[model samples]
Target: MIANVLTIAGTDPSGGAGIQADIKTMSALGAYSCSVVTAVVAQNTCGVRSFQALSPDFVAAQIDAVLEDVRIDAVKIGMIANAGIAGAVADRLTHHRARNIVLDPVMVAKSGHALLDPEAVSAVRERLVPLASVITPNLPEAAVLLDRPDDWSVPAMRAALPALMALGSDHVLLKGGHLEGEDSTDLLAGPEGTQAFRAPRITTTSDHGTGCTLSSAIAALLPHHPMPEAVARAKAYLHAALAQSDALDVGQGHGPVHHFHALWASDG
Candidate 1:
């Protein structure tokens, strides 16, 4: 069956991140996509200029409308701009018993713009983290979530796993893209232990929406594959997208990844 994946996120008009990227990633990965917009952000590949979040009630209603009719196979949640929206999302997903929840703790954008409200951090940690099947947080996000200094090494990332797991997620995908190296390694920690998935770091400024794309890919693949397999496949997909990102020229700053790299290749 083609999985129906729901993405609860903010918007990026540039179409590189947020709900737009989620939909594109899901469709590229062969999943049916649905979305609930939490905020409308004025951002391009360069940076975020400003944003306005939807009311909590409106966001909840959108979730309800989708959940009431569609059978959501998995959910990829991105930017919940504030605490109220976070709580509302947690409550609605809980009430509906949504499964295969993949939470990307999106705190900052590629251009160093803050996407999430600092005050909402505790609410997301308390309400949303535990409900997720897996939570993906890069070094800075993990540090902020854990109230610790940013980890600069793999060993520090490894050592931080238990504390991150204690956040109540069944699995934690601690991304090491921020670490300086030839390979971007991501640590997947679950009840069994931690495992590393590595890929050569593709050198390109076209890295916008990478985090959103990765998490959404995992959510799209989870219905048919186990956690480890899903994560591995998602990593591979993102790697390929990043590798071919230079093929497209979208913005002045970091451009979007080529989500349709395979399809475009076939066409050529």
Candidate 2:
């Protein structure tokens, strides 16, 4: 049967990231996508200007409605915004005993705007991370989640994975993309061990939705695919999406990776 994935996230009116990106990713990968909007942000390729989070009760309602009818194969979470939303998510998932939860710890946008509230960090750590099937955090996000200082290095980042695992997630994907380096390396640190993927850094400004895209890809591959395997596959999938989107026209500042790149290439 085809995978049915749910993405609980914010909405980007520009449709470059958030729920738009998740749905695009799932569709590109042949999975049906269900979305629950946690917040609505007034954003463009330049940056986010303002945002409003959904009521925590409404957030819980969306999840309950989806789960009551659809047998969700996996769930991808992004841009939860604040503790209220985080608590709402945690409560619903815990009650349902949902499986294959992929948590993308999104802190800041590619435009350097803060995407998560500071107070909500603890909520995500305590309520969400423990239940996540895999937690994917880019260097800065990982540092924030683990309280690693600003000067943390790759080795230091690598060492923190175990501590993160102790937080209760079965697998922790520490993304090295934010590190200062020629190549971006992402590590899948889990009980099985660490699996790393290093790719040549593509120097492009079109990279607004990477975290959302990666988490959604991971979700679409889960339960049927092992954590390590899913991490590897997701990286490759996102790489292609980025490469194919290299020249597409979108919003003026940092554009989005072309989730339908594969389809465009195949038709050519």
Candidate 3:
């Protein structure tokens, strides 16, 4: 059966990140996609200009409306915007007993724009993180969540895993893309143990939506695969998408990955 994945996120008009990227990633990974918008953002490859978050009540209503009808196989959450939205989302998802929840703690955009409110950090860490099946956080995001300096090396990342797992997520995928290296590695820590997944860092500016894409890919695959397998496949898919990203000319600063890279190649 096709997995029905729901993405609760903000928007990026440029289509490289946020709800647009989530839907694209889910669809590319062969999952039926649905969405609930938390904010309407005016952003492009250059950066975010402004954003207006929806009311907490409305956000909760959207979640209830979807969960009440669709059989959501999994959910990918990004950019809650504020503490109210975070609490609302957590409450509604909990009420619905949502499964296969993949939470990407998106704090900032690629262009150095703050996508999440500072006050919302605690709400996300306390309310949302506990409910996630897997929480994907980059070095900077991890630092903010843990109230520690960003991990600068693999060993540092390893040391931080226990602390991150203590946040109550069943699994934590600590991304090492921020470290300057030839390869980008992610450390996955769970009840079984920790494992590293590494890929040669593709040199390109077309990496606008990588985080959103990866988390949504995992959500799309979780219904059919185990956590580790889903993460591995999602990593592979993102790698391929990054490898082919430069082919498309979407924006000036940072363009989006070619989500349909495999499909387009097959068609051609």
Candidate 4:
């Protein structure tokens, strides 16, 4: 049976990030995808112009509507704008005993637009982080969550890993793409200890939705694979998507990675 995955996040009309990217990643990874829009953003590969968030009650209603009927194997959450919405999401997830929860702490956009409100950071940390099975944070995001400066070096990330895991996630994946390097390395810390994942950096302006895609891909794979294997498979999938990033020309700025690269390359 196909795994059923749900994404709770904002909308990116450019279809390069947020819920759009999440759904694409889920479907490409062979999962049935669904979504609840937390905010509607006016953005493209370049930057975010503006955003309008939905009410917390409405967001909760959407979650209730889906969980009451669907058997969701996993849930991927991204871009929750404020404390209220974060609380709403946390409550619903707790109530449903949601499995395979992948939380992407999406604070800033690729173009440096702030997707999350500063006040909401505590809510996510205190209310939502503990509820997540895996929390994916870039170097900068991890710093903000820890109330510190951004430090992208490998040693810094390693030093910060235990602190991040302490925020209550079963696993923490600290992304190293923000650091200057030929290889992008990510450290995953959990009760089983830490594992490092490395991939040659793909030089392209088409990495708009990388985080959303990676976390969603992990969520899609979790029902069938163990945590470490799921993360490994997701990284492989993301690397393939980035390798084929040049195929799409969606906007004048950074374009989106090709989510369905496998299907596009299929000879069948």
Candidate 5:
């Protein structure tokens, strides 16, 4: 079956994160991608220079246009940067339901620029997150969402995982890449308790779109396979993408992880 995935998020002109990353990741994982762009970022590896958000009505229309035709099996949501867009997308999904909905609560850029308005946190937690099948939050985003400071330890990180689960997702993948550690461990806590994926620290500046890629991978994979199996496969794909990130010389500053890495080697 062709897994049709709908990605509702912002556009990254740099092609590292946001809507671009979601589209690339979904298609690479064998899913057809449909996008509803919430905002457009004038961004590159250095960081996001500027951004312009679409009106809530336009965002909804984009989603409607896609869902009206394509049979969206899964939904992967990235940077819904404001409360209005978040609500619009969440409310829209009430009717156009996908079997798998992965929410990557993208609040900050890789370069530390805040993407979502701080005020929109309530809107996300209350309106959007509860509606998701899975919610993926990195350390900083988790801390902010949970109202904890940045001084959280591994135990603290694990502690917040349950709270994220409580927010109503069937599963919660709390990415620990932002946590200081020798090996980065992302905690997947859900009804089955926890599953951890640990990878050696891949010290690279090209880590811009990893979250978007991972969530989209989950969304794409889950419709065809079980969640645990899907998450494991998605993590591996992202690791390989990060490992081969050097192949893409797309921009001047921090670049995107190479999605075509496997293709280049296999075709040669």
Candidate 6:
């Protein structure tokens, strides 16, 4: 059966991140993609110029529209934007008893624009974090969630895992991309303990939608694969996408990773 994946995220007109990236990632992985936009962002690789978040009721309606009609296999959530929207999403997901929930705690953009409201942090922790099967947070995001200084070292990331998992996720994938290293290592820690995935850092500027892409890929694969296998496969797919990122000439600033790298490569 084809997996039906739903993504609740903000919109990126640049098509590099948020709902655009999630849909692209899901489609590339052979899953049918659905989306609910929480905010409309006027942004590009350079930075976010402005954004308008939708009403919480509107966001909730969009989620219900999809869940009530389709048999959603998994859900990928990103960029809640505010506390009200975050609470609304969490409430709806709970109502549906959603499965295979993958939450990417998107707080800031690569261009240094804050995507999540500081006021909404508590809402995400209280409402959304507990609902996730897996929570993917980069070092900075993890720090914000835990109310600590940004620490990206391997040891720091490893030490922080159990505390992150304590937020109610079954697993925590602490991304180490921000750490200065020859290899970009991601640590996945959970009840089964921890495992690390290391890949030679793809030196490119086309990493606009990496977080959205990775979390969506995991959501897409979860219906058929276990947590560890899903994470492993998602990392493999991300590495391929990052390697081919230079091919996409989208923006003058950081461009987007190639979501269909596998298909394009196979076609050649």
RMSD (Cα, Å) of candidate 4? 1.3
CA lDDT, every model vs. true structure: 0.95, 0.89, 0.95, 0.93, 0.86, 0.93
Which residue pairs in candidate 2 collide? none
Please provide TM-scores, in order, for all candidate models, with all chains considered together: 0.98, 0.97, 0.98, 0.98, 0.96, 0.98
> What is every candidate's alpha-carbon RMSD to the true fold?
0.9, 1.3, 1.0, 1.3, 1.5, 1.2
lDDT of 2 by residue, 205-246 (tens): 888898999999999988578888888888999998888776
For candidate 4, the 10 contiguous residues with the lowest summed lDDT are 259-268
- What tens-digit string does per-residue lDDT give for candidate 3 at 115-171? 899999999999999999999999999999999976479999999999999999999
Q: Is candidate 1 or candidate 4 better by lDDT?
A: 1
- Kindly list the per-residue Cα lDDT of model 4 for residues 109-165, writing each as its tens digit: 888888999999999999999999999999889999999887568998999988898
Cα deviation at 112, candidate 6, in Å, is 0.9
Clashes of each: 0, 0, 0, 0, 1, 0
Misplaced by over 4 Å in model 3 are 266-268
Q: After aligning candidate 1 to the native by TM-score, how far in Å is the CA of 172 from where it should be?
A: 0.2
List runs of model 6 lying over 4 Å from the truth.
Answer: 265-268
Model 2, 166: alpha-carbon shift in Å? 1.3
Candidate 1 wrongly placed segments (more than 4 Å): 266-268
Instruction: Write one digit per residue (lDDT tens) for candidate 6, span 105-158.
Output: 999988888999899999998899999999999989999999999846899888
Worst 10 residues of 6 by lDDT: 259-268
Among residues 3 or more apart in sequence or in different chains, the pairs in candidate 6 whose N, CA or C atoms overlap within 3 Å are: none
